[model samples]
Each structure stands twice: as C-alpha cells, then as structure tokens.
Target: MNESKHNTQFLGLLGQSSTFISAFSVAQVCLTWYVFSFTGSAVAVGLVAILETLAALLVSLPVGTLVDRLNKGMLLAVSGVAGFAVFLILSFNVLFFSFDMAAVLMLAVVWGASREITRSAGLSALPDVVTSGTIAKSNGIYRALRSSLESISNALAGGLIVALGVLSGFLFSAGAYLASALFAAFILLPFLKSKTATHPSGQEKKPSMLEDLKEGFRWLVARKGFFLLTVSATFFNFFMDMIITYYVIYVAVGINATSLVYGLILSALAAGDVSGSLIGGRLNLLKYSGKINVVLFGGIPGLCILAMGIVPGIYTAILFTFIVGLCFGISVNVWLTTAHNIVPPNMRGRYFAIDGALSSISPVAIAAGAAVIALYGIMVDFIISGILMVLFTFVFASMRSLWKLDGRVHKERPANEAT
Candidate 1:
C-alpha cells in the first residue's frame, strides 16, 4: 500500500472510532448522573465501575486471542454492532419502563466487554495500517481528535440530559455505534485487505491460542524494563482510580457544582489532552522516554492532583485536573508508541490485552476509595491518593535500569529478540 492510501484509510478508521468514543462518553455521563440521582451515594457509582471492570477482566484474555486470530476490521465492526444493539435496548427500556438497577448492571457488563474488544483490536491493528516511522504521529492524531470530540460530546451531554432527557443521550450513543460499524465494514476492511495482500507471506505454523497467551506473558517477563513499566502503570491506575471513581461526586457534593459545571470541567480536561497529544507527537522523546515517562506520567499528574486536594475549589480543581489530563495525554502517546516500536505485529494484540488487564486495577481501588469517602470524606481520600501518586513517582524514577533504557536503541532489534 502507498503511504497516501494508508494514511487515508487510517484516518477514516480513526474518525469513526472518535465518533463512537465520543458518544460513549456522553452516554456514560448521563448514566453517572442517573445513578447519582437515584442512589445519592458515591458507593453506588463505585459498585457500577467495579462490575464493569470485572466484566472486562473476565474477557480480556479470550478477547486478546480472538483479536490476534480474527480479522481486525471485522472484530471492530462486531464490537460496534454489539454496542449499538445494547444501547438501543437500553434506550427503549429507559423510554418505556422505569430505571432498573439489575438491568443496568447487566448492560454495563455487555458494554464493558464490547469496549475492551474494540479497543484491543483497534490498537493491535494500528501497525498494520501505518508505516513504522509514522506510528507516534498517527497515534497522537487519533488521541487528539478523540479527545476533541469527547470534549464536545461531554459538554453537549449535560444540556441534552437536562433538556431532552437521558433517552436522547442513549439514542445518540446507539447512532454513533451504528456509524462505527458501517465505517469499519465499508472503509477500513477493504484497505486492510489490500494492505495484507501487499505483504509477502512466510510459511510458519500458527501457534495455539494458549501458546499465544503464554508467549505474550513470556515476552513481557523477558523485557524487565517494560515489565516494570507495566507494574508501575498498574499502581498508577490504582491510585488514579481512587480519585476518578468519585470525581463528579466530589464536584457535585464537595464543591457544590452543577451538572453544567461538571461537564465544563471534563471539557477542560479533554482540551488539555488534545494539546498534550499534539505537542507530544512533535517532540523526539524516544531517546529520553524513560525519564519523560516518570515526569509526565507520575510527577506532573501527582502534583496536579495534590494541588486539587489542597485547594478544593471548583475553579482551581478544574485547572489542576486539566493539567493532569495534559500530562497523562503525553505520557500515554509516548508509552503506546514505544510499545509499537518494540512489540511484534503478531503479538501486539495479546500484549496489549495483558497490559490492559494489569491496569484494570480500578475495582479494588474504587472499593477502597468509596470506603474512605464514606468514613472521612472526599477531601481526605483525594489528599491520600495524591500523596500516594507523588510517592510512587520517586519509586519508579529511582530504578537505574528503567532510567537508562532507550526506545530507539531497542527498535533496531527484531521484535522477538527485542523483547
């Protein structure tokens, strides 16, 4: 495939992905508001999150294997269709019937499964659609566009819910998923086929699914730096979840903010994400990725959250959260691009899934955070989470092996040997 054709097709896929993700964000916001309205407790929100994470965790390994074996475009289309169906059903129920917690929990499980499948498949398919040299830029573009759309959708969601009710949000969510399915089928699948045709085949026996799973684990274990990075990320997710699980509640109850304010705060964060992703793409951070990771991922985000805890004002908290989003946006692009540079195409799906599962440490963290909020209050939990995040940065940064690691140096090796 020519570079122009690859870029066009990749952009099409990304556009559809961005649209669906934006819609999902809107639906999520509406659902969160509904849950909070009904239960009036942060613990209920935490429980919902835990259920979703548990469902994703259950399917991660199997979905990883499927993503590697199946056609990536087809897998993404299926995921979209599943999301559309689920949301459509939810919309109908919400319109005609009363809100049912049990039904919502079941839908969350299905929704979470579909989300994980699509995300893994999309990330795994990126290398197949773009040249290696352009991976970081392409990833940055995708993130920037997605974040931009999310900002718009989240801002719209608050008004839509207030004016037209939650059913409208669910309808929009269903429509977006349907569009994603159509786009994948019509635009991405054909290009993927052409791309595959251009590659020269080698006669090698395919591994069993179990073998593939084991290989992914072994690859991560062999690369000490990457393994440690994953571990550090797991802890980061744990601490971050403590804050995120109750972020909206904190704004609503703690700071006495309204739904519009909640939406505006999220929009600010997404705007910052867009800025960071674009900037990160322009910088050459591969050589110093290790140090960059420690600062952007841990140092900046920790400080931002710490400031939020101390200030505890809506305006200041929004500024701090936006900065946190900006830093993480850059860190995410760098980390993902580095992974693409090192991981082989054949193993990327499983590798990403396993890494994703590791980071799905939200369930326990949400439970603990909710308990703390119940006991002491949101401020105490925020302060504790911020402290832990800052402390972990030093721990991650102190590793001499990780600091000396360079992604560009590793990129030269064959993927198998690089691990």
Candidate 2:
C-alpha cells in the first residue's frame, strides 16, 4: 500500500478505537476504584474481575462464531450500542437511584458481554483495514494508545471522583461510551463493512457452530507456533490477572494508600505500558525477533517482583509495578501480532474467539489462586507467579527448536497482490 493509504487507515483505526478503548478503560478504573472504596476488600475487587471474565466467556463462543459468518463491522457497531445502553443504565442508577453494588455488578455483566464481542470483532477486522506488513505496527499503536488512554482516564477519574463525586464520574463514563459508539459507527465500521461484507461466489456455506469450533481447533493444532503462542498467552494471562486483581489491592492494604494515591500508582504503571507499546510500534517488535525476546528475557518482571517482595515499600512496589507494566506491554504487542499473523483472514474471528475462550478459563484459575493469596498472603502468590512467568519465558524461547516451527508461518501479503 502507498504511504497515503496506510496513513489514512491508521488514522481511521486510531480515531475510532482510541475513543472506545479510552472510555472503556476509564469506566473500568472508575468502577474498580468505586467498588474497592465501598467494600474495602481485595477479594471483592477480585470478584468483580471474576464476574467480568465469566460473562465474557459465556458470550465468547457464539460471538466468535457469529463474527466469522457476519460482517464484523456491523458486529462492532452493535457491540458499541450494547455498551452504550449499559453505561446509560449504570449512569442513571448511580446518579439518581443510589449506586448500589448489585446495580454495579449488573452493569459489569453488560459491559463484559459487549467487551467480548467488540474485542473479537475488532481484532478480526484488522486484516481488512491494513496491509500485512503494517499489521504489527497497527497492533503496537493500538495497544500503546489503549495503555495511554487508560492511564489518562485513571488520572482524570481520581480527580473526577474528588470534585464531582462517584455519581458524576459514572455519568461522565457513560458519555464517553456514547461518544465511542458514534465514532465506531461513522468511521471504523464503514471502512471495515466495505471490505468484509460479501460472501465470495462458490464460497462454501457457513459451517455449523460445532463444525466451526472443530475447524478452529484443527487449524490451531496444525499450526505449532500459533498453538504454543496461545498456550504461553494463557500463562501470561495468569500473571496479568495477579497484577490487575491483586497488586493494587495489595498496595492499598499494605501501604494504607488514599484513593488518589492508588489512582496515581495505576496511572504510573499505565504510563510505562504506553511507552513500551509505542516503542514496540516504532521497532515493529511484533515480528519474530520481538517474540523471541519474550522467551529469552521476560524474566525481568520476575526480578522486579523479587525486589518488591523483599523490600516491601510503597515506592519500591510502584517502581516494580511500572517495570512489569512495560515488559507486559512489549510482550502483549508481540503476542497479539504473532497470533493474528498465523490465522487466515476469514478465520481470524474464530481463531481469536477460541483464543479468548481458552484464555478465559485462566481467570477461574486466577480467582482460585486469589483465594489462596487471601489466606496465605501475596508474598506466596508473588513468588509463585513470578517463577512461573520466568519458566514460561524460557519455554517459549525454546519453542522454535523443540517444536520445529518457523515463526513466519502466515506472511502478510500486500493488498495489491491479493489474488
């Protein structure tokens, strides 16, 4: 593709996805902070995460199948609409009806379902929008923006809660979601719909749900790198679950942090994530070289944890968290790009869906592990999660030799060259 075309597509994706993802991250941080403030329990915060992931899992199978058969753009728009409604309802209840935990949980489920569909569709639609060569940069830019947005939202959310109160914060979150829906419909969806809508003549009929599921599984099994990448992602998911579900809460309890301080810590980590992701974009780190780095050196986060666990101070903890966040951002950009590159364009949705479903199961394990942490404390959990990550890093680094798999399995062909 020409430079002009590439830039246009990149800008379009940036506009729509940035708005939705920023708003989504803002809402999530606000909700989590609110829940933590209200309940004063780490387990409660963990439960919210558990519920969200469970809801995503429940909706993932059908949504994944539907994306493969339908226009992914339409699906993304519908997801935006659903998300808009959810935020509106939550806003109304929180602003007027007394913001109860039950009401919040209900909205969380709605948000979770919308998140599952939108994420799956957004990922699948990428190949329709950008040339293969730019896909890694695309992933990098998306993740970078997402991380930055989340951090900015966290920073603003802390002040929003202080100045306007929780109700106003929730309402503001609703407005952001509404804007996201509008941007998605007018900008991103139209671009994608034009490319992905038609069924090719003599194309086989859409497969049944079971058949689709089986086909996705068969495809994954046949592709060794893709399969290992997914498996590594599962372990990665567990480590992240620890960070998101337990780390902040640990900070709050261990350090007796104020709400603003907690927000600051989160924003700090997000800032690291943003930087890492953008660097990834410039480096094209989603390529094979970047992924190999994950296997060889990803133990940096483990070392960070070892320091945090031994020192156990707020400043040290925050620094450790930030380092981990940076490493995670790099790891995620490489992981997403590698996996997406492996799948056929048409099967991208199903591939990501199955990936989501498989990854979803890890949260259950994470929640169980959280319970253990609650009893045994984070010292144990931190050491164990860190060690596991280090081990997985080595395993992933050795995968090429062990599995006899080449990284460039699904090279992205230029759009003009498409037959």
Candidate 3:
C-alpha cells in the first residue's frame, strides 16, 4: 500500500510539470505571435516579457521563506489553481471581447505569481515522495519528457493557431492548468516543513522571513565557490532573456518569417533540448569533466547565436537554435542533478528560491540590452550577445571554487559515477 501510494504521488508530481509546462509552451508561442502582430515593436515585446517575469523576481525571496513555513504541496496546488484562473479569464476575454494589452499585462502578474509559487516548491517536494535511489532517474525522465512535450507543442502550435486561432490555445492552457492543479492536489507527499531547519545549529526559535532569506544567501556563499559562480550564472540568464525577447522581434520584423517558419524554429530548439537531455544522460562523463562539459554546453551555444546573426538564413537559424537547445539540455541536467546532491533537503527551497530570484534579474538587464539593439540592429545584437556570453562563461569557469567543489564531490562518491 505504501509503495502504491508513493507511485501515485510520483506520477502526480510529474503530471503537474508535464501538463502545465506543455500547455504553457503552446500558449507561449501563440501569445508571442499575438503580441508581435498587435504591436509590431520589439520594445513592446520586451515590456510584455518583462511583465510576465517581473513577479517571479519580486516574489522569489519571500517564496523561499513561504516554502519553508507552509505546506509545499498545498502551495503548488494553490498556484496551479491560480494559473487556471489567470488563463481562463484571459481566454474568455480574448474569445468574447478583444485583445486588450492592459488586460494582458495585468493578468500576467497573476500568471507570473502562479508560476513563481511552483518554481521551487516542485523541486523541493521531490525528495519526500521519490526514493533516493530513483531521484536521479526520475529527474532525467522529467526533463526529457518536459523537453519532448515542448518540442511536440511547439511543432503543433503554429498549425493549431492558424487552424483554430490563438484564442483556442489560451483555452487549452486554462484546461491544462486546471488538470495540473488537480494532480498536485492529490499528491500525498510528507514534504513537510520544520522550524528547526532554519539554521545549521538547530535553534528552537523560529526564524523571521528576513532570517530565512539571509540563511539562503549565507548557505549559497558557504558552498565552496558557488557564491561567485552563482553571480556568474546570472550572466547566462541575462543573455538568454535578451535572446528570447529579441528573437520574436527579429523573426517578425527582421526576417519577415511566417508563423509556420517561426514555429518550426522553436520546434527545432526544443528537439535539441530532447536530444541533449538523452545524450547527456547516457553517461557519467560530466561527473568527471564537470567544468568542461558546462563550459562547452554554455559557450558553444553563444557561438551558435553569433552564427545566426551573421548568416541570418532560415535553415542556419533553425540549425543554430537546435544546438542552443541541445546545449541547454545537457548543462541543465548536469547542474540540477549536481545541485540536488550538493544541497541538503531542508535548505533546497530557500536555496532554489534565492537562485531563481537572482536569475530572474535577467529581464532588467535585457531591457538595457534592448535599448542597444534599438540603436544598432538585430544582427549586431546577436553578435554582441554571443561574444559577451562566451566571455562571461569562461569567467565563470575561472572561479576556483567550482574546480575544488567538483573535485570534492567526485571524491566523495563511492564509485565516482553519477547514479
């Protein structure tokens, strides 16, 4: 009975991610197209993207605290329910009325809030339900399937949008959110919170939110060289956001690609994600060459971005996008797995929240970047992004802590192999 219950919870957990993400992925493509078509300005696109993510940056720190204080499972369910409301309302507005930018921006806040709630809670909730032996396999499966779903969704989104209109995609997103919420609602995981967990010294008194927030930062810095590396990691997100925000503009304004071509490129990117996850997980090579793997995965993608800018052909752009996705797949799988092992379960929520908050700052940086691209052009913007990405990646690799930490980590493993 216990094993059966665990299986149900595990599946529920996967369902929460698989359903919401896939739906959102499809909706994302449709929404981007809608916004670009409506405004025809890259800056406006950036503004919309900024609004969508702004909530995550603002609330992540507190979310770290709340995740520790409250029931994670309940929080996720509530967030999913909130997502249901956000999208459902938007769907109705689009179908019955018209596409109001003000309404879209306002509803985006609620959508982002819902997304923020699930970001850390889902990962932190994993250990309680999944046995230690299977956590690694489960995570790989989760990522691979998530990427696969994104590929399928992106591939279909354009055809679906043309066939059924963007409004239908919004409705599909609403349904998917509801389904995910229901799945999370029934997941019976004992991923409970403990007050004594705030500090390493086992203090009986409960810590304030400020204290919890500080502990997260304190722990991140304490982990060898992760503190500096953490800051460097932000550079990746900064550039990544710039790319995502601008790509839609470039495709629409610069190349005049049709919706079909746009969807194909996005699908290629996701297909690479699927390939990277599968190929990267095939061996424990990353465990030995952690820094190298991370660098290659990250740096090479920047080069791809550069090539796309220089060449700017449809086929080349699709090829480069796929490489970018492939690299992301390998790097993400490696780093997330490493983090799961390195960080303690008690601190996972806070730590992930802090990391998320830092990474979420990408939107702000990309806003400034958008200004530069406005002055120059899209091709030049890609060239600059590629150069800076590579430079920062190597700078991140230069940190001593990563090397020492990797050495210590591999040394601690019995067989020096990632299970």
Candidate 4:
C-alpha cells in the first residue's frame, strides 16, 4: 500500500484502540468506586490495586517477548477479548449470584494481564504506523483523544453507578471490550497481515524467549540516561500510585463528598489532560522538551498535589488536581516521544515491558500507602507523598546527563527509520 493509505489505516486502527481504551478507563473508575463502596475499607481497595499490579508484573517479561514474536494486531485483539470475557463473567455473577470478592480479585488478575498486553502491543506497533518525525504528534493526539473520552466516560459512569448501580457499569464495560476486540480483529488485523508475514518463516531459527528478553534488557542498559530516567519515573510512579489508590477514599470518606462529585473531580483532571495533550501535540518538542520536562514533570505536579492537600474545599482540590493532570499530560508526551525516537523499533516491546514492570511497583507502594493512611490519616499521607515527589524530581533534574537527553537522542537514527 501507498504511504498515505498505510498511515490512514494505521490512524484508523489507533482511533478504534483509543476508543476501547477510554471505555476500559471508565470501567476502571467504576470498579474502583464499587470496590471501595462495597468493602468500605481502604485496605481492601489497596489489596485490589496490589493484586492487579502483581498480575501485570508476573506477565511483563513474557508479554514483551510475545509482542516481539507474535502479531501485534492479534495480541491487541486477544487482550480485548480476554477483557470482554472476564467482565462478562463478572457481570453475570454480580447479577445472578453473590458479590464475591474472590471472583473480583481473580478477574482483576485477568484484566491487569490483558491491559499490559494491549499496552505493549500498541507501543511496539507505533513505529510501523507513523514516521519518526510524527511520533510525538501522533502520541499526543492519541493521548488527547483518550483523555477526552475518559473525561466524558467518567462523568457518565458516576451517574450510571448511582442510577443503575455497579452491576450495570460492569455490563457496559463488557460491551466496550467486545467492541474493542471486534475492531482489532476486523480492522487492524488486515493491515498488519503483511507486516506479520515478514517475520522469519516457520523453518527459520528464532531466538529463545530468554535470549530475546536479554537482548531487550541489554539494549535498555546501553542507554544510561534513558535507563536512569526510567528509574526516576519508577520512583515517581510509586508515589503517584499511592495517591491514586486512595484518591476516591480521600474525597468521598475523608472530605465527605458524593459519588457524582468525586467523578466530576476526576473529570476535571482528565479535562486538563486533554488540553495539555493537544498543546503538546503541536509544540516543537525537539527544541523545548527539556524546559517542558523540567517544569511539568519536575516542578508543577508536586506543587499541585501539595496544594490539593493543603486546600480546604473540594473545588480547590479539583482545581489543583486539574493542574497536576495538565502537567502530567505534557510530561508524558515528551517522555514517550523521546523514548520512541531513541529506542530501536524491534526492541520497543521489551523496553516498554521492562519499563512498565519497574513502574508497576504500585502494589508495594499501595500497601505502604494504605498502612500510612491507616496510621497517619489521609491528609498526612498526601502531604508526605507530595514532599517526596518534589524531592525525587529535584534529585532527578540535578543530573546533567538527563537534562541533555533530548539533544543526545536527536543525534541517533530515529527508531522509525532504524531498519
């Protein structure tokens, strides 16, 4: 196919994938609320979060290898199908049988695994879809669209949960996953057929899974600055997860807000994300990425969180959270764009998987955060998290090598043009 046609098909597939992801994101919000409401225990919510992260951790390496060896389109489809099946079962059980925490935890495992696979496939497939020059723009647009949809979905889901109850939310999520699966199977698979076939024939020797994983890790280790950046991000993620795990609880239980109010606060965050992503998509990241990262990642978010904690009212908290999301949206675009430009296309899957696993230490963080909340109270936990976040960012930014990452990365052959 011609380049324009190929790009069109790729964008179309990505759009569909984003739509499915937005729905899944909404489902996650609903599930979080449901779990907390049903159990009324911060520890229970923390356990659910931990279990989900553990599932992702267990499959990270294998999923990375599979993303490289298998058809990415098929991987995406399988992920959606798995999600659909699990949620459908959950919905049925919720409607017909008792509310089983065990079943919910089991489904969390499956859902988490599927989410990791889908994310890996998408990251690995990006280079095949767009030119190196447009990676940042494409990623930004994708994130913006996803955030916009998520905002709407979250707003709607809050009302849905209140109006129709939690079971209906699960049913809607099941349908969303089914639609995602259908889109991947029918739309994306056709375009990827040729790409998949280009791999070695059945008779050709393929590296062992262990070797493939080793190669991925080696590639990552060779990039010292990027590796360190990932480490810093992992730390950042650790604290961020703690805050997220208890955010709903803090707003609903601590601050005494309704479910609808909580959803609106979340929606405000997503709205800010949408705005930042749109702006990020259009900026010349090659020129100003460093400044953007220093401000957005290193400075703004921590301040926002700190302000949110100190502020007295829900509206003030929402405003601060919105600012945090805006910074996060821009920072994430810069980070992903830089990574995509530097990493070899063939190794993106493994790179992303390893990075994900490192960042996915949320389970441990959540457990810790839960304990802290139980002892120190939510307000104190937020203050500590914010302070640590600021300290980590300062330490990371003090590294001269990290500040020069964008310049050094531009010197390399871009990933999309690698092979």
Per TM-score, the best of the predicted structures is 1
Q: Write the per-residue lDDT of candidate 4 for residues 225-294, one digit (tens) a residue.
A: 6777777778888877778778888788668888888788888888899888877766866555555665
Report the C-alpha lDDT of model 2 over 215-294, residue by residue, as the tens digit.
77777766555576667667667665665566656666656666666667778778888877766556644345435445
The per-model lDDT (C-alpha) reads 0.81, 0.70, 0.74, 0.78
Q: Provide the TM-score for each candidate, comma-separated.
A: 0.94, 0.88, 0.90, 0.93
| Residue 374 miss distance in model 3 (angstroms) | 2.1
Q: What shift in Å separates residue 324 of candidate 3 from its native position after superposition?
A: 1.0
Model 1: per-residue Cα lDDT over 1-419, one tens digit each: 34523577787778668867876788788878878888897888888888888888878888888777777788788888988988899898888888788888888898888888888888887878788778888878878888898888888888788889878888998999999888888878777664431222573666677887997888887777777778888888898889886878888978998888878788888888888888777788877767777778888888887777778887898798889879988888888888888777767888889988998878899999999999998888888888998899999999876775566635434335433
Show model 3 residue runs off by greater than 4 Å: 1-6, 188-204, 286-294, 407-419
In candidate 2, how many Å is residue 333 off? 2.0
lDDT of 4: 0.78
Off by over 4 Å in 2: 1-9, 197-200, 203-205, 284-298, 395-406, 409-419
Q: Which candidate is the best by lDDT?
A: 1
What total of clashing residue pairs does each candidate reach? 0, 0, 0, 0
TM-score of candidate 1 against the unseen true structure:
0.94
Ranking by lDDT: 1, 4, 3, 2
Error of 4 at 93 (Å): 1.7
